[model samples]
Target chain A: MPHDHHDHDHLSASGHPYRKDNDGQLTYWQTMEIAIRELMVEKGELTPAQIQAQIDAMDDRSPANGAAVVARAWTDPDFKKRLLANGSDAAREMGFDIGPMHLVAVENTIDTHNLIVCTLCSCYPRNLLGLPPDWYKTREYRSRAVREPRAVLREFGVDLPANITLRVHDSTADMRYIVLPARPEGTDEMTAEQLAELVTRDSMIGTGLPKSP
Target chain B: MTLTPGSTVRIKTMSPLGHIRTPHYLRGKTGVVERVLGPFKNPEQLAYMVPAPTRTLYRVRFEMGHIWPNAEAPQDTLDAEIYEHWIDQNAP
Candidate 1:
């Protein structure tokens, strides 16, 4: 195995000891990440074009597309029906496959809510959302996401009472999730484009709800 | 002993049980013999740089609810490649 020259600096991004510069850069960790990424390219493990491809593809993230889906769902009941009937197909109809991921939606109601986690490793639906946030793959997230989902959700600003069921979704299988959070109030007259703007990635991931502006 | 060919796994190290690439989520869970597959060589030691004698590998299936009750899922099946060494008699 190729020894990671950035092993020492990687500790910062690994959630152990992170030190920030006055300008707020990860500094040493960033340096190491660049070095490691460059080394992987130099060794032909990954190419500069591949890195650029990923960068170019970043804006094409699934969350953004999911937001548009939600916007469409909100506007047209037929679209909503199609979405619920076939998650992956519905996403494709909107112009993309949630990727290789199997899209499963968790419907929320006045009485229950859903949250997702990958207890073993990060098994996110990259097709629909692109790469997952770093925090989603931590040991703390893996252990706690299953055991104390309610508590973890609270940290993300979701505080539901005991009467409201807090369902935790441990993504152990090939299946992945995208929470269709309830559309907030005052969006009745909003255009699809306007509504899509309000749908944040975190909200679709079930970490929060779209705010009314 | 049913892990088939071409499946991803999550292996861990053990003493008597030997090092198996079973995910921690299904560590103690028991799965029925879905399908008995070939005697492929274990990849744990190779992946982790142990360089030990190769062992048998198998594919196993587990219920999703069994792994995570809070999972908001419509179906209930998770198939994974598991080494025979990690299986315990008490698994069920």
Candidate 2:
């Protein structure tokens, strides 16, 4: 049998020394994260159980929850009123607790469209719609979304009519924001469930729109 | 200072060292108070895992042309939530 050499030194593409741990096992940041977490737990800042519970809560959410609320808002005028008035309370009414972060739902109208972004950081309505997309966290998007919103919307394949003005909401503070996209023209006859299916995550972010028909 | 909706206010030009929620571009810019989002704990201090005092936050609206004067469209608008401390009652 040919001699099998199993040991091969692996190096990170960037040639960063921090990529390797004591035994070349874990990355420096990974090791540091573990150290910090363990220290916090040891110091009684927070228990591992508390961290796990928060993770579990986050894992339980998805875009479908927000879509369901949007669909309900489309079907029921009363619910729509409530959702616009107080988003967190309205979400709770639909069996979703949006945590301590106050959520604000802004409606898209025929005259104007609304786009949401966190220029300072990726501050999003995670309780209602789960974690944000990778692009939403990028610096390119964060800066461009506020500086040139119409251009950014175009890149997302959202070509708006000149008659309609665009409104960009930079979520720089505590209140989380979600866009209530306008109901597609041909989706009037669809059931709430059917309508929910057309409500894409990007639509709620104001980067795109619901499926037409 | 509490500002009613539709009243114009200017963002202060102070960038204190440490965690800040206000964006650099919006500093010293003028905008109208879209809505008062009520009082909340100061996030600038909260970021450092320290106790924070409650401060009033307002949703300030800035016109697109005003924010980016050279932009193609003048009808557009942008909104950002700013704390009461970072705003001046008088607009420039």
Candidate 3:
């Protein structure tokens, strides 16, 4: 097993030692993840070339895709209106899904900003982006994030306006949230590709805003 | 409830027995034991590591209000399967 450096979700009840099946019986389910991999190789689930084809068919998972959609929104006034009206369909029009959840898109005007946290698990928009960072799933993060978002963001060196309303979106199930930051000044002359580069993951997470380059 | 000196109350992330889906967010925060729900399997089954490890089941609760005070939504209760080892009985 790859250990993978699992998170520290240890409860006070976690003091017990790991129990190993003394008789030595490995449950089939225990081996299922690897089993599927082996089966694919043995059964020729796809040829080496075909595997690439499958991968291509699947949409890329990353914020880059979201950046593209936001860029389009910035360039096209009509698209921005549509995106605000129908988040799911507007994102679909951009050839994307929120990835993990179908939560709505709410814009942050001059007065309000939004942030997201998965109080349950890291139920993020996987389709919109690839794997989340390692810190996202840590127990310390999960426990303390929403309770003290400003503090957490400060750890990342983010300084938010005290007067601006901060909304914390907790992802319970498949539902997700995306922040539409107030477009920065002086970027009106930039191209869509240029705009895409400005929208960082932190900005989308509601901790920061897109910067002018 | 084993009464041992020097224990504290906290929410457990995984059950030592039975099938449970413990959220990563609630582990290690202080919560009162409303009442015992009885023994259960460790769904967060550490015993899965050992072929058959003995584990007892209990129902533990943490207040949703305690988790998020400003929660616009109203859900007063949160319950889950708790293994004996996952909790420590601390002073109220």
Candidate 4:
């Protein structure tokens, strides 16, 4: 069996990961998805291999893609300008195919701080930053991120000074936003790759700052 | 009406029961157009799998104070992308 080669600690009897939703109870959405997938496969609309490949491609995307872009912007002023002007093209320049997503890069400066939230639904830059954090999809985060941004940021351990202006972006429509966090001081000697190491996923989301060197 | 960047406009307050991209909180709120994000298919029609006409979308910026009276940071701002049909050109 497939379970023979896998670690038993985290695997269920079915050899699938132990998740709350995988408790043998199929949800309505899950039922619909399975039925649709099977029908599509039977009708030759899509092959099982094609579906698996799509899933694999999505799983391959991570925050590291966004980190590399941030690092490049920090080290190269010209690239940073281009990134600020047109984020989609800048990401494409790095060889990351973001598809038809319209990306907007908002800069975080000493006097300004940017935060992103989708009040209507979970509209995220998945192509660039992978899937959004679970907290981002929560109703509380979606509601409070715009109403009381300062308090919400403080909850995430990001306390801003009164002098700094906060800008909360609500992803209501087509465009996806990424915060271009300010570079931490005293990293002048680091390479672009080394700088990417400090760029955290939360920094790009505007919830937390980049790690200090 | 074509809205230029830096033009002050108010979001139309309409609660049509359907798949709308506009959030309820932004209705009747006034803001400045920060940028014109070009034209895109109207999501209202697209959600129903029907033909949708392209509409110009704008990035509108609003001051926190204007949105909420008891705003913790009055100087802070909020930005959202609004479709052309949702925006009212006449701003008092």
Candidate 5:
């Protein structure tokens, strides 16, 4: 018989393991969330299994998905053309299942640079890149990004030359944006998979550049 | 009327009490339409869970100096998605 490794102290009276979050004091919002979730489950509107599966799906998404797209664009001209023309369709073609997010791809060129922010709220391309970094949602970043993009980019270690025009995109409504960072030079020999290793989440957000090979 | 790309338009300055997507800084500022982003349900109405009508959204590109008095770089630009109702086509 297989030995059970369950720790007695971690188990409740009902023999169920205690969730880590259950230890904290329930705030008003947490209480409300529990109430609503229970009500929905009781009313048969949703199942506990369904909710867990949904969470699992969200957890599965990460910046790696976006890195692959960026790498593909770097290597393939036709894919890059389609990606620039229609970001949502191109991502769908790659089997990303980004849902109804109207993604717009802004390219970083030799003379132009692109940055994205949501001044109204923290609207990000969560489907493609997973949850945004904590700083991206802060009031400081949201306001500074549009007002002084050059200064903001400098803080992120991306100092643009005076010749390069900085373009800051405020995702106010309907559409989401993803920056197609300029492909680093001297990467002509690298494969798409190897190139993907260099695409960081910050690079996609236009706050930083891809890692040098 | 649908706004064409490259047409100059100004965002109307108004502070109605409700959930609004138009940023306060861009109000009364003029910009050129970068592209027509098609129609979307009015977020102001959708926020209240009401029957929202569709409104055309345009990507307007504004000069940094035009939007701010002490812009770090005047030549740099800012682009934002503005709804049809917030844009005035008759701006001089």
Candidate 6:
């Protein structure tokens, strides 16, 4: 057997920092990210502290943010109108900064349902919904969503009536989309805060629906 | 280029050999200008980490049947954001 040369404080034999799991082995993409980050820091393009801060900032968001926007839209018709008219501004009203990208809120009506997909990439409304689920970044979801959306929805446990036309939005370029699913039938009496609890991340992505109360 | 919302437009069919935002499935597809999404720096050039001029982007809506002939519901639709440079005159 080979000698165990792993060290925690110093670089391993392969020049990579020893992680908890792998014996100094890193995936290709992970290695690339590490190399690029190190190069940027060495060139003074960005400091390691700045990169860490950016990562921390990304972690600050979650699906609950999107749920809050959805719940507010369901409770207030005026807010719903504003959200449908200008999603970025409406999100701001709820204290969510969506950055520079343009956001569009698509409403799911009795006759129509909206589904969002980034066929070319996994571009998502990260500001409101946080980072996308792992499956969202997979090639399977990207291609299947554009080709057979209903089938994909069924897998996610969202079954719609055949009469209800399904509209699929392909986010090809800069625009990011979020679906405002129709409120569940029995939620008429629920408060906005209570309704928000029923909203799931998948619902905003158009793959699921709010829990029925 | 400024596009009037609701005006019918056709996506030009051009397969450039480089990083392009327009998907192959939407090439030569006809759609209506849903809204102007404003101007932004060209991502194609940004990918190279170079300074690029801003380009207008538009949200275009297309009928499901137009994109996929065998679409289950004829009334279904699909919307996509396309750069202004990728669009041509309206289809007659």
Candidate topping lDDT: 4
DockQ: the better of candidates 2 and 5:
5
Per-residue lDDT of model 2, residues A1-213, tens digit only:
121122235543435333223445678887788899999999999998898889879978888999999999999999999999999999999999787769999999989899999998899999889989889999899989988888898999999888998889999998899999999998878999999998999999999998887
Q: Estimate, for each residue in A71-115, the C-alpha lDDT of model 4 and write its tens digit.
A: 999999999999999999999999997888899999999899999
All models: lDDT? 0.65, 0.89, 0.60, 0.92, 0.90, 0.86
lDDT of 5 by residue, A56-114 (tens): 67877788889999999999999999999999999999999787889999999999999
Weakest lDDT window of 10 consecutive positions for candidate 1 chain A: A1-10
Off by over 4 Å in 3: A1-35, A40-59, A97-103, B1-92
* Residue runs of model 5 more than 4 Å from their true location after superposition: A1-22
lDDT of 1 by residue, A26-108 (tens): 57877897899989988989987787777667656757788888888878889888876667777888888455555766656
In candidate 6, residue B2 scores what lDDT?
54
Cα shift from native, residue A118, model 3 (Å): 0.7
Candidate 1 per-residue lDDT, tens place, B1-92, comes to: 33444332333334444443455666666554433434545555665776556445454555446667775441334445455666563333
**Evaluated on chain B only, what is the TM-score of candidate 4?**
0.95
* Superior candidate under TM-score, 1 versus 2: 2
**TM-score of every candidate:** 0.59, 0.87, 0.56, 0.93, 0.92, 0.86
- The superposed Cα distance between candidate 5 and the true structure at residue A208, in angstroms, equals 0.5
Please compute DockQ, using alpha carbons, for every candidate against the native two-chain complex.
0.09, 0.80, 0.05, 0.93, 0.93, 0.73
Q: Write the per-residue lDDT of candidate 3 for residues A108-197, one digit (tens) a residue.
A: 778766666676667665556556656767787766566666667677676666665565665543245567777778887889999999
- Which should have the higher TM-score, number 2 or number 4? 4
lDDT of 3 by residue, B1-92 (tens): 65222233675555444533445555675554433434443444452564435454443444455666764322333433345666654425
State the lDDT at B88 in candidate 4: 73
Quickly count the clashes in candidate 2.
0
TM-score of chain A of each: 0.73, 0.84, 0.73, 0.90, 0.88, 0.84
